[model samples]
Target: MLYLKSIGTPLVLVMALFALGGCEQAEKSAQQMLNQAAESAKQAIDKTNEAAQQALSEATGSEKTDKEDSKDADGQKI
Candidate 1:
């Protein structure tokens, strides 16, 4: 009985420390995953914004050039 009592307390303490360390590692991993997801989302938004701006410019540029080419009888562009 004396030998069991002497060993049991230290064994329980070691197991408790191991469990706490595992929990800490899991928390760190979860945080890293969240950070990566946020970065990907930001990149996606930037790409979408660039595409929308390019489409808008392409749609509007031709009409502007045509208007500039057409001149009035007074030799001035209307």
Candidate 2:
């Protein structure tokens, strides 16, 4: 139908944009680009681990209720 075509066309355009987002070339200087990507990924993982450790350190308290309270206050899920 005409309505289906209208909705599908916009969705297709949006999907196309998303699909092209990660298609940037890895740079003419391949070694530099690879090293940059590796460093960025490493820093991201390190920050994630640091956040987890700080959350645990904050939440592991004297009693079950206190631990639960700290977790709730910090908005830490699980």
Listed per model in order, the count of residue pairs whose N, CA or C atoms clash below 3 Å is 0, 0
Error of 1 at 65 (Å): 1.9
For model 2, the run of ten residues with the poorest summed lDDT: 22-31
Top model number, lDDT: 1
TM-score of each model, paired residue for residue: 0.56, 0.44
Q: Which stretches of candidate 2 lie over 4 Å from their true place?
A: 1-28, 62-78
Tell me the tens digit of each residue's lDDT in model 2 across 30-76: 43444555676688899999999988876764466765766754679
Tens digit of lDDT per residue, candidate 1, span 1-78? 334234354445445555677677656665565566567668889999999999999889977878767977686977
Clashes of 2: 0
Instruction: State in Å the error of residue 50, model 1.
Output: 0.7
